[model samples]
Target: MFSEQFNVRFYETDALAHVSNTVVAGWFESGREPIFKLFSPNLDLRNWPLILASYKIDFHLQIFYGKPVEVRTYVSRIGNSSFETYQEIWQQNQKVASGNTTLVRFDFSSNKAVPIEAEIKSQLQEHFYPQQESAK
Candidate 1:
């Protein structure tokens, strides 16, 4: 798993004095930076295009200003041209939010989605999370 920390600044708080909904989304996106680095140390957007297809987040608790938030990310799944990222936000050792994002590898020149490269796939495999079996 990859982790990053962020402090809840006053500007990130909503009128209710808690971190805003949209700000939480930004935190989840930030969680992907390290995972992206695994594929290309210096990701060149023009050459290797990636597009976010969708994301889902469940808020478990409120995150307040001045508190430190930790975001943990992992490669949850991989496909030919798309990959899934799972992330959790922890504040004071408690899980406050968790989510997943789907990103598709794209070819800007061809104006279409492209298959994930072999090298990238190999690196991503190292970070895949173990799948959990569903309860009957």
Candidate 2:
């Protein structure tokens, strides 16, 4: 798994003083940066190869501002033309939220999904979710 820590900014909080639900999505995407670099070295939007198919988030606890949060990311599934990312947000050593996102390799010109390259698939395998940890 790959992870990153982020210091919560004041503006990210909601009226209730917890990090806004909408902000979690952005944080999850930030955790995916390492994986994104595998597909797009410079992260150029013009030639972006992946497209989001769907995503789901579950909150386990509230995430307050003024503290740092860590996002852990793992590749849960990899298919011929798509892959799924599983991520979790932790604060104060407790899991606050988790999410999963499905993204497909696409051919923008044709507006169709395409098979991922063999080398890329091999690289993705290196980031698979550990079976033992999944039990937690």
Candidate 1 lands at a TM-score of 0.90
The alpha-carbon deviation from the true structure for residue 95 of candidate 2, after best TM-score superposition, in angstroms, is 0.6
Q: After best superposition, candidate 2 residue 65: deviation in angstroms? A: 0.7
Q: Score each candidate by Cα lDDT.
A: 0.86, 0.94
What local lDDT does model 2 show for residue 15? Answer: 96
Pairs clashing within candidate 1: none
Candidate 1 structure quality by residue, lDDT tens digits, 95-128:
9999989999887888898899888988887766
Model 2 residue 59 lDDT?
A: 97
lDDT of 2 by residue, 1-136 (tens): 8999999999999899899999999999999999999999999999999999999999999999999999999998999999999999999999999999999999999999999999999998888889734754
Judged by lDDT against the true structure, how good is candidate 1?
A: 0.86
